[model samples]
Target: MSDIPAPELAIATRNLSKQFDRLLAVDNVDLEVADGEVYGLIGPNGAGKTTLMRMLAAIEDPTTGDIYLQGERLDPDRPNPRLKRYLGYLPDDFPLYDDLTVWDYLDYFARLYDLREPGRSRRLLEILDLVQLIPKRDSLIATLSRGMKQRLSLGRTILHEPVLLLLDEPVSGLDPIARQQFREIIQVVREAGMTVLISSHILSDLAQLCSSIGIMELGCLVESTSIQELYQRLSQQRLQISLLGDNLAKSLDRAIAELRNCPQVESWTVGDRQLTVHFNGNETDSANLLRQLIQAQVNLYQFQIETDDLEDIFLQLGHQQTS
Candidate 1:
């Protein structure tokens, strides 16, 4: 088999901190993202996810700490022109020229980026297709929907072929179909080897898209782990059984007794016609629990494992941080 190339480190932050007056907007944080990796920063309102992004993009200076791009220190005080050449940032609120047509708007940015005549046309067409805005190229920007406007903004951001894409709430207001389209575009960019740092409150999207995620609360990063690591660490091995009966409490007690007597079962709980059994082993132990329930003649209407989802983990961490 051919060897897979190692993904280069595209962005890194060390002890990154930012404050607003006496309030700490972003606490000391560290991050490392590989080239072509989709890294997500997730949190509730006022969690400082956007502040961290701004600092990384060099749009804002951190009160303390350092940021590096491609192994070179990012000098915030003295902005580097070359740094901007391969970095694209899409803020939560996208601004557009109301009078400019979709094509004209992109062309203007291409000129600003110093693309020559031939290169300018080539780049514009490429980004338009990538963003799926080719059909609306001649349409006025004012006539576009929220999703279309977002696509146009993304096209403008990547007009210069930036290697790093920093997007904040890219699909905040998009409809379900639009959101799906936006995700597809991001995946396409990832496949093309562009590193993406997307911040959003939508845990479902992050779970589906991000290989790694950082959960922040009150200006501090609480959890940073790969998707698989998170699943393994937070996996719930409890089985939930719901039985049909008028004497629900009696059925639940009987189920718990049967589960507790099993050698593989560690513990059990009875809750209003429901019996939750915590197995001593992993999923393999669940089969034993089901067999025992059937042999005991427990009228089981529904029997399933209770798995902790990304949202559940996020909420648990957020509550811990707040407490």
Candidate 2:
């Protein structure tokens, strides 16, 4: 063996793939997730994200390739109690018992996981609190709102306190408030040392939560990198200048005329009371441009730099096109 030490990974796969009849759902995917990472997967519908997640969750067998979890080979063919204890998977189509109360449903799953009294009760309470469902614990599952039901489903998924969590489209249909709540809960678990692999179409939420992101197209992982690095590599700089007072129209016209001949400005659009310009310059260039505008009597009210977010980067990569 060489002197180089292998990097520790929470999840790793070698040329992983899956096929259904004629369709190759997940094709030759090599993924690595580090310990305590919140990895986000983004893609259009039918891009194989759900299928890949199923294989990672051990609910589906790959057509070819090897999967390793924490350096241990994952052999789904054989029963591995250790792997079971370390993993928690919540699929998109998770089910809940409509007749059972929230607490009762959680208790049922806790027992299924072989959790005994005292400890089981303690774990249930902790989960309820973690998912912000403590207040509705005694209510019937059918009575809970869509958001509340989803939270309860998540509570069941982590009842065993698994170290590795696989969540597929967890916030698919939740309202803004519900999505925010779900994001906070995920952050808490991440802080508690859970390695989360979450796939979602909501790029804004992923931009806020993920340490790194993987973009899928067709059946391939087209790009994977840290969010910061993605921004540095593909994101562009923009400048927004809003005009002041009742002479806003005149100010906008002057700003447009100034931007028209500026070598630092690539392009610009005229908005109601502002100009959004694509700038190809550094901080000093921006400051100098502001000074020029002021000297030209542009009547500027606010000058701001707007950097591209994850959604912009995704669109820039052109991976949002349907497979």
Candidate 3:
């Protein structure tokens, strides 16, 4: 840490590392997380994801390296108390007090964080509203569903309006519907201008929420890229079509034959009256293909471009590493 002005990057780390006895948990790493961007950290079981999170949250010190938040030094040895005003961390297994009501729980945290006066009460109501827990404010924490508790935990994190949020597996153990709801909450927070760093093994979920992703392997950040750029680098565009009308099998046979011969379509598969095509073509070519189908009198029920999924992207990267 130094008095000299640091670079004004949102979150910057220079050669950060962590050593435990003979093992290096986090290798020399340089990272930059831009302001207002949702950055996801991903890796396998022993890839040091938790350790890195702790280091960033100022819970543990890096063996060597420096961290800067908005161009100011983040000293692990002497972390500033005011840093809490700008940062919030949600660990993987956050505990809760089942004995307290939602309002009381928040009020307790507000006081612990040294929040003052009428503002603290106002912020509590605002957060309850944001978490959709206004109705549950009087309800005991033990009476709430897992989803509600998750949102409530999130509300606790945002009580002070931190600029950066560090969430580790925030949606773990959630059902599909719950996961979707959690995603929506995160989207709202992102729109509110908070930069976020999340860690999760679920690539699909990260795909939905993250603007960019970083992959870790053997204690190193192997790759870092934007979602759009990662998709382009990993695979071509895909188009899925569901055909309608009678003679459906015959329609698909004709469609597959013609589509296979088309220069724009790299390959295609047909099943359940649906066609999935790997296409690497421009919009003009796509439009022309649809126009040709209409001219050929093929009944079109649904035609949509399938976005590249993160599972395949992760697999492709795995294969590349082996190669």
lDDT for each of the candidates? 0.84, 0.89, 0.85
Superposed model 1: Cα runs more than 4 Å off: 1-7, 245-251, 262-272, 276-280
lDDT of 2 by residue, 1-323 (tens): 11221457888888889999999999998888889999999988998999999988888999998888877778878979888688999999998899999999999999999999989999999999999998998999999999998889999999998999999999989999999999999999999999999999899999999999999887899888888888888889999998987887777777887887689999988787878899988999999899889988989779999988888888878744533
Compared to the true structure, candidate 1 yields what TM-score?
0.90
Runs in model 3 deviating more than 4 A are 1-8, 239-261, 267-277, 290-305
User: Alpha-carbon error at 96 in model 2, in Å?
Assistant: 0.2
Model 1 lDDT tens row, 1-323: 11222236788778889989998999988777777889999998898999998998888899998888876778878879998677899999868898999999998899899999887898899988988888999999999999989988988988887899999999997898888888999998888888899998777888889998888888888888887898888755677788996876666666777776778776776676777777656666777777787787677899888777788888877667768
Q: List the residue pairs that clash in candidate 3.
A: none
Q: What's the TM-score of every candidate structure?
A: 0.90, 0.90, 0.84
Lowest lDDT 10-residue stretch of candidate 1 = 1-10
Could you give candidate 3's per-residue lDDT for residues 1-323 as a string of tens digits?
A: 33343465567777889999988999977777878999999887888888888888888899998877877778877758787568888988999999999999999999988889989999999999888899999999999999999999999998889999999888888888888888888899999999999988777889889999888877888878887788778755888878999888777766776696679898887778789988888788788788777777777888788755887777777777779
Candidate 2 at 198: error in angstroms?
A: 0.6
Backbone collisions counted per model: 0, 0, 0
